[model samples]
Target: MAKFDLKGLLNDRSVPDRQQDQKIVYRNPKDLIPSEENFYNTEKLERLKQSIKLLGILQPLLIENRDGKDYVIAGHCRRKCCIDLLNEGNDKFSRVPCVYKTSSELEEDAGQEDDIVRQIMIIQANCYRDKSDWEKMTETLKMENLVKELREKAPMEGKTRDILKDLIGTSSGQLGRYHAISTNLCEQLMSEFEEDRIKISVAYEISKLNKEYQKQACELYEEAGILTLDDIKGLYRQQEAEKGIPGQMTIETATGQNRPPEDDTEIPAETQIERFYESTNKNMKNYIIQEDKNMTIFMLSNLYGTARVRNGHLNYQGTTAGITFNPGRVFEHELSWQSLAKILIGKYGHKKPIKMVSVDIPEKPKKKDNEVSGPAKCITGKSKSGICGAAAYCDTEYNCCAQCPDDCNSRCGWLEERCQPAAEIPDEKQPDFVEEIADHPGEAAALPVMKNNDQRKEWLRNYKLWGLWYEDKNIGVKYYKYDFENGACLIAEEYILPGTEWMPEHETAFLHLVGGPEPECKGGIPKWTYHARYYKFPNSETELVEFLKELQK
Candidate 1:
């Protein structure tokens, strides 16, 4: 018998696809050594079992004789099925057909423990099996190592991926992505991916994060659910930006070398305002560290700034430059704000005591919700009762009282029996802000200088602009109007209609003020629901700005 053409047989170009010993013989199903690698999924394996239970082993198992033992190279599913049937008292499956490789056909070095030929032949035999992305990744990675050994052992003619493209039937680019996912993703993330819990694209994006961020992302996924590509990318960017700050539980911190002071007494943080300037040293602003929590959380209640180290100074930009320890650290001792500030200066700031000031805290304006805002009006023409009127609350897309006519673009879904016409509803209300601002001119004049979007957003909320005007370089200009006059503020995009100033379109978002308005109900709680395409109730103006910026991107 001639030497077995394993490579030619794998590529399907050889005449003899089987070993030299062609005679098929019956053997004990339990006696055969099962291959450790099985690529068939559970459903397919079940189907294979059913097929063998009815037809028996139609195809003989391709067996390799290693040191007087029969090892299965193919037909693993068939042999397992036969053994299962035999266990179920079906004596017919006690013996199964198999074709064994002749001793002369075996390579001289094939008896070695880590024989590369055996590994390649095993993977190549199941190349056509249905496999998940994770399975493909794992198998391809194995093949990559084996192929590298093969190249070093006997100089291959093509690149590793090219050789793999022929051997495993996976693309080169896909193989690269697989390698990246295998190397970068945390073990928890990899397990989730293996079970098909997380998407491949999302997993690939998460693979770009460092180990700490990867662990964080895995935790977020387990807590909140699977994260999207955008979420992972945002996390990656945040990790990149915070790299200079340290205290991300590095080696020293993790080993407790960088632990806080011994005294754990709580100290009231003193308020200190420092005159800080931008990178260009122009447009100086006052940055105040109002309070601290565990000497870690330094909140700039009235300011927001991005801090960075520049030219040997703890430089910062924006009005709210806050200095504090990283919140992720676990400290045993509590330190005063002054002490924490000194530590910050040692790391990223100038070695000097911060300037102090006794500025008066401004009083926040109280909101009156039950004042003059009218009810939501229906736009879907006459209801079954008569002409549909304004509703105490127009049902949003979440729960529609009635099937809307125009996809509820008007954000109105009042049932015919429930709502009346505007003529009968009779909304008689007065403006809340015009009179107050007119009376307190000094209070109105004390508005903060609108230097950034954060300040501008604060101005809008304080003065009650009832709208958001944003100008983007790429998107040109866009405006979002708040319909506060109608119960809950139905945030909608307003468009100019000929001579009309602005007409509100469908509701894109909404804001329900703490003391905003009361709904006049005929029955049931008013559901001011619309198909909130996107909605977020940010706790602060800075957060709102960040959310809007993400939307623009």
Candidate 2:
């Protein structure tokens, strides 16, 4: 019998146009290099090992040649199992079946094009394998980079997301959630999420908090065995509330004429870029722009998106929006730092107000004539001029200043704090009221008829019956019809709507808010007008009652 030429067979398999019926050949397990990437944990790896021992390599491995080495591509775990069995004196397992991948079948793993193609192949090959959320998220992020490159290299192929969807079975919305979770959540929380201890939706919300707050939320979850949106929101509200507490030291307190300084030492001056980077990194690390190789990557906080700057061009992608801009020149000025930030916000802010991220110095608060009286103790004994000479409190053990005296020249660092711009409240427009009511609902009489705008606003503010409220407890209703000439107030105690994947839209009562200035006809005959809107949220009294009950528990 003619000797079967395994060498010739393997060599023939490397040819691009080789026969379709490629035969599998047995090779020493040591000859094949295990794949570098490993997503399986020890438990899963052990299970794979046991399965291999039982099944005895029923399926052949896929191998590719790279730099004169046979590298395992799809069957990393199987190759590992063979090697383990061979090490245990199982001579039968020394040689395992593998099919050589053709040159045309796999990319050369060189250059950017090769890198993207290689990632797509690996992701598709492992699609059948059971993966953790973290692993899927990791693959999704890799695919995101591949999508960007593919778009740049082949702009006319298709939409970026459609290409990504083909490469990896993930929607654009899901990719955003994965990106947010991976970028913002702390390591502990991420691990918990990966291990299935936390839900992805809950994890995404928790990612909005800083690392410290994430850790706190994680601890709460551990104790309670459950974490909800309300819990996460409560923690967020607590964090924001701590920022502007009453009597708390403000930027004004440090630099004010009568407020004590944090310390007598002078802080070194920071450049605009350094200041912007430091403040953003400290407060909102997710939004902090990071330098990578020749490009910079920045996050769009409001839009939950990301963008990159390279070669004097900007490329941005978000959940609901995308943009590309080329200024024809690289930004080199200090002011360009802030200008660039504003440009990103303006394009992707989705009509939201601007974020105060620039390094602009805040205006100092005006002091009241009777805000403080009498001589105060200086907290820092060592002032810029000399020793502070306020009072005996300077000599006290605390050595802290109760307040800076009127004549004290000590420079306060309070002037350095970033100030949020005052919220702009637009003047309310009065609605044209109809003199006669045509078909007023009986409930319209129950609602107080306010004569003026202030009374209307006050009523809306005090309204606890049903309305969209702000996230912050102190802030009142989000939507109000101040100028509304009430035509009807319909309340649905129970609602049945189409259910979504997440949950039903409304299980509780909601308002069928029908109030707005009726469309007017300047010179035409009178006709009844009805402006109706639906509010399904949060505006429910039953929900609030249930929430309060849960809080009491």
Summarize candidate 1's per-residue lDDT along 423-506 as a digit string, tens digits. 555323312322232232122233334446765565445433443432122222223333222222223222221221111222
**For candidate 2, lDDT tens digit of each residue in 101-128?**
6544223322246655555555656666
Off by over 4 Å in 1: 1-9, 12-16, 19-21, 36-44, 102-114, 224-231, 240-553
Query: What lDDT does the true structure give each of the candidates?
Result: 0.50, 0.47
The positional error of residue 295 in candidate 2, measured at the CA in angstroms, is 71
Kindly provide the TM-score of model 1 when superposed on the true structure, using C-alpha atoms. Answer: 0.39
Task: Estimate the TM-score of every prediction.
Answer: 0.39, 0.39
